[model samples]
Every structure is written in C-alpha cells, then in structure tokens.
Target: MLAAYWRGEITLRKLRVLIQYLPEDSPARWQATDGRPFTIRDAMMWRALWSVATVAQQLAGKDKNAFENMPAYPWSKPLNQNTYGSFGDHTPEEVMDYLDSL
Candidate 1:
C-alpha cells in the first residue's frame, strides 16, 4: 500500500474505501506513548495511501473541483455508522489527527 502511494497509483474513491476501515481514533489508539492500546499499522498505511491518492487526483486533473460536488464518503457509507450504529460527524482535521496519531 505504501508502495502504491509512493508510485501515485491510488485513486480518491479507493482511498475513501481504505479510510472506512480505519478506527475513528486510530492515532491515539496506536501510539506507543499511548500505551500501545491497539495495533494500527494498517490504518497508517491507508493514510499514507490517501496522501498519494490526493496527489494522483491532482496530477490527473481531477482535483478539488471534482471532489467538491461529491458527497462525503462518496463511494460508500461507513459501516459502523450505517443502520447498525449511530452516526457521528467528524471533521477532516479530526480524521487527519487520528491518522497522524497512529
């Protein structure tokens, strides 16, 4: 996954799919200083891939303008927030902070 990001082969839609599997508080959950509460290398990998996907989207001339019209989580709704569980709103900054924490 990291290799894909480094090679800029990811897509925004795919990136969103990856993000859906990451924990809401992945950073705080995986940090060594946070007592290694949970293992989250996979989340970190996806976050890195997301960065690459953003770059790829820009290079392909399908930048923010393309995403602006898309709904949040355009490809699919988060599983945990679907009919089985209550939905929670989170800002992009919060999501990034979680990824960075991991």
Candidate 2:
C-alpha cells in the first residue's frame, strides 16, 4: 500500500475498500500500543489514508468523491479524539526512514 502511494497509484476508493473489507479479526488491522485492537473510528492508518485521500480529491477538483456516499462502520463517527496521540507526525522523509527501520 505504501508502495502504491509513492507510485501515485493509490486511490480513495481503494483505500476505503481496504479498510472496509478487512475481516474483523484480521491481524492487518492496526493495534493500540498495548496490543489491543483499535476501534474502526480510531484506526490510525484509516485516518492517515483519509487525510491523504481528501488531499488528492481537493487537488483533482473532482465533483464526485470516493468517500462521499460510502457505507461506514457503526463506531466510525465522531472519532475517538486521538486516543493514539500524534506519534505519526513525521515528514515524508522521516516516515521513509522509520519505515526503513522496520
């Protein structure tokens, strides 16, 4: 997915599908620091993907957007208000470095 983002092939629709279609017990779902699962509303990767997707939509100036009419999870609204804090506040280069270390 990160590779797709860098290659400019990532789309909001795809990201939404990726998030929405994951099985409830899939290990790919993001986790909290203590290893608990994140509520869908508070999923960090979802928020980041949303942020990037919104930016893409604004840049393209499209009348129709991917997320505008999509179904949402029951707990998806009025988000958890940053329960994970801001640990992902790195610049693109910094993020690349962090990813490299993994």
Candidate 3:
C-alpha cells in the first residue's frame, strides 16, 4: 500500500483514512490476507507502512518505497522485516509508539 502511495495509486489523505478504517466488520477485516482474519496488528502494520511512505516522500521529495522496518513482537526489538512478520497482536498505543520511535 505504501508502494501504491509512492506510485500515485492512493492519496495521502486516503491512506490516513484507511489506517483508521479497521472496524471488525469492515472489508479490511473481513477480507483478510492469507485467508486470516485482520487484527489490530494488521491495522498497525498498515498504519506504519502508509505513514512512513509519506514521510519518506516528503523527506526525499519523490516516490520511494522506504521499506522501513518496524518493530513487532516482544515489542522491544526491531524485526527488520517491517510488520509483515508480526503476529498482528499489538495494541494501538504500542504501534503508535513504535512508529513515533521511527
């Protein structure tokens, strides 16, 4: 999704809105990837991705994946694999702190 943003496939405003549309009944939850149910962790992962993508674009003044690594699990170490490796169980505050730390 961050790549989509960089590629002009989604607007920053839209991305920000998407990060919050994580209700349990929403498609973001119902249409979970890998046939798994979407959880807060997934929401957090996406929030970080879309956010960092915009940050990178602003810093670089151009489109780029950034591919920023986000910390997940144990919640104290950098996974170095973004949030994909996460079990998608982090709390909203935890995810926010991680992103702020970035």
Candidate 4:
C-alpha cells in the first residue's frame, strides 16, 4: 500500500489509512502523523518492511527503491556506518527529497 503511494498509484490519503493500520509503535504510523521520533525497534521494522516493499515494487516494474524513494516513516535516520556496515551512509533525506521532487 505504501509502495503504491511511492509509485504514484495511490494518494497520500490512502497511504495515511494504510499506515494507520500498523502497530501503534510503528515508525510508519508515527511518521504519517507528524514526523515524530521513533525507537530503534521501530526503525528496524520499518527498514525491513521497506526492503520488502522495494523488492515487490521492482518486480512490478517500479524501479524505485522503497527506502530510497518513499516518504519518511517517522523513525527514519541516517544509516550508522559502524552498525550497518556497507549498507550504512544512506539517509532518509535522500529518499524524502526524491519523493518531494516528484
């Protein structure tokens, strides 16, 4: 559902409802509300789900990476170099910027 929004197949209103269905602690839920801060667990779950959405979107001919193209989901952060290793160094800013630009 979120991936649908990223791909321009859905509206922000619909995305809001989809996000609202997540657990209360979900970063996506918080982010959809007001960009509130989130816990580490929230960040981890969001990233994992984003990765899955990215793959599914790609398979559907949406070249966008869910983590790199979608709206920020509250707990989004700059990847920690020491913790995330090679996958680190990216930031939600890049993704959010792309989305806004679109």
Highest lDDT model number = 4
Residue 38 shift from truth in candidate 1, angstroms: 7.9
For model 1, give the 10-residue run with minimal summed lDDT: 66-75
Note the clash tally of each candidate: 2, 0, 0, 0
- Cα lDDT over the full model 1: 0.53
- Pull out the clashing pairs in model 4: none
- Which lDDT values do the candidates have, in the order given? 0.53, 0.57, 0.61, 0.63
lDDT of 1 by residue, 18-87 (tens): 7567764566434432443334454466456666777787797654443333322223453333353322
Ranking by lDDT: 4, 3, 2, 1
lDDT of 3: 0.61
Which residue segments of model 2 deviate by more than 4 Å?
A: 30-102
- lDDT tens digits, residue span 1-102, model 2: 656866879887787787778865465654522344556445656666766776787688742344563323324543333343333445567766887999
Model 2 lDDT, full chain set: 0.57
In order, what is each prediction's RMSD in angstroms?
Answer: 21.3, 19.8, 19.4, 19.1
| Candidate number with greatest TM-score | 4
Candidate 1: C-alpha RMSD to true structure equals: 21.3
- As a TM-score, model 3 comes out at 0.28
TM-scores, one per candidate? 0.27, 0.28, 0.28, 0.33
